[model samples]
Target: MRASVKRRTKTQQDVQPETADVAEDVSDRIRATLAKAISEGALKPGSKILEDAIADHFGVSRTVVRGALGILEHDHLLERKRNRGSFVAAPSIEQAKELFEARRTMERLILELALGRASDADCDRLNAIIDREDAIHHGTDEKAKAELSGEFHIELARISGNGVLTELLEKVVARLALVMTLYEHEHHDDCGTDHHRAILDAVREKDLKRALHLMDEHLADVEGRVRLTQDHGDRHTFEAMLASFSPQ
Candidate 1:
């Protein structure tokens, strides 16, 4: 009987690792689903995430759901509030300014690095992305345009052959998505593709000066579209009537 009891104990211990692995896989799937939703703008900024509902819908434990939400929070895709559940992060105007400033600096550096390292084939890859960016007309969802526009910058970072810069740009671009959603003027037109084409043309010609100049103007145009003026509010008013426009 003592031998049988010993065997039972060992069996239970052996099962633990498998159970843990299953839980981890479930957690990763949950994290990926939530991340994609946030990326695609299905979950808009300032929108609350219902943890219990997610657990129930996925047939998983709340612990697993929390684990997934924790990862998203780390990515700045979701913000967890004390005594409140997780919500999609909404960047304030101040945060928006900082993100754009950082992106402008990062992008210029990324361009310089990419120009030095990129092959003729790499330049062609960029042209292909621009081709895709121009494939759809204005009738499509604006989010699609933004997604492709973002891919352009991310591809550029990847071409720089620097993993650190790639990671940083990815995070900054993720946050910038939230910023654009919250603060862009209704009539603001995105002009990313044209600028990208010109920059790529300069790159292929090895004209770094022209490429850099075009990049600066492109960054300015992007930042100029966001309404960054101070407004009266408890946190953010979001009153369209009271919204101020940036200089044209």
Candidate 2:
């Protein structure tokens, strides 16, 4: 009887850490899914996140959902109220202006540095991303295309060979996605591939001045299209929005 009890106790103890790991895995998966949804515009700014419904959808406890949302809140992707739960962050027009200004500064530096160091291989990699963008347009994945749009900028930062700049640009780019969510109009979600190709070609030809000018023009074009003084709302529940992303 004593031996049997000891074996059962050990089994329960072994299961405890495994259970905690599973909970953490659930939290991470939820965080990534929510982040991607926000970036892709499926989860628009100011949308309320129903914790209970999300918990139910993922078959996890409310505690797990809270953990995931807490991570997003830390990233500024979500905001929590004292009694009202979490909602997607909605930046004001002032905040949007600030983000774009900062992006312009960072991207100029990024492009300048990348131009100085770009090898033939780097140009090839950038062209591949553009090719992928073209393919995404012909396919049926708007979200992928939007994500690639953001990635193109980040990739430029990466090729600049500045890790600190890359890190800063990543945060700025993420916040800019939220700005786009609040202000972008129909058919204005991308920084046209042609603009990207033009910049890449200038870099390949070692035309520093022209590349810098094109970068400025491209960012100006993007900022010009956003409606800074407009109302923003979307009529989709959190679960319903996420459900659309799920496979049949």
Candidate 3:
């Protein structure tokens, strides 16, 4: 009878749905926090991820933190090791080049399609996004500017009216933002203004060829701005982690 009671207690403990739900909740929160950090450039590339520190910071169990880390690993934000703990992702120079090349190809295609398909309303919306980006750029908040700059491209993709291409562009833009944050040496002053204006003007003019050409130039400029040196040091992860503490 004693053995049966113990077995039943163990089974009940193992089958607790509430415990699983709570664990999932913690995992989501941790993942969001880390993702925000990466987006903000606080947790830079190659930074070490200490699970215990995150668990302590969030007041959650290490199990929950591990789950979150696993998700981030899948997202290519965090990397794991056999014995050592997880670390933030650091994109190589070759990877960064490949990412930009992909963006250039994909963005040109998007613009080529959008040149004729995008309505006046779509142009207006794109203009509005650029305005917001300008405000964010001039504001004292650098992180907000960074986020808005990335968002501007995503907004353009949405206006292109192709769901499949938009999704692909979203992922590409996210990776580009990560690369820019990790590898850029100097910030571009006209990051959001000139290229967007050119693209919008070409779209408004309904000149598909000109629009595509302008997009190529815009992407080339952006690619050129990134300083991709072969430094495999662990600074990226640390910087990304620090970026999460901003007011955003």
RMSD of each: 5.4, 4.8, 5.4
**Residues 174-237 of candidate 2: C-alpha lDDT, one tens digit per residue:** 8788887667654553457788999999999989999999999989888876778745323223
Model 1: per-residue Cα lDDT over 62-159, one tens digit each: 99899889988998889999999899887777888899999999999999999998899899899998887777435476766545647888888999
Off by over 4 Å in 1: 1-15, 138-143, 186-191, 230-248
Of 1 and 2, which scores higher on lDDT?
A: 2
Error of 1 at 101 (Å): 1.0
TM-score per candidate:
0.83, 0.81, 0.77
- Tens digits of per-residue lDDT, candidate 3, 120-196, equal 88889888988877777778887676566466577777777789888777666766667887777667755847788
User: Model 2 compared with the native: what TM-score?
Assistant: 0.81
Candidate 2 segments exceeding 4 Å error:
1-14, 138-141, 230-248
lDDT of 1: 0.80
What's model 3's lDDT at 169? 77
Output the lDDT of residue 70, model 2.
Answer: 94
lDDT score, residue 121, model 3? 85
Provide the overall lDDT of each model, using Cα atoms, as 2-decimal numbers. 0.80, 0.83, 0.76
Better of 1 and 3 by TM-score: 1
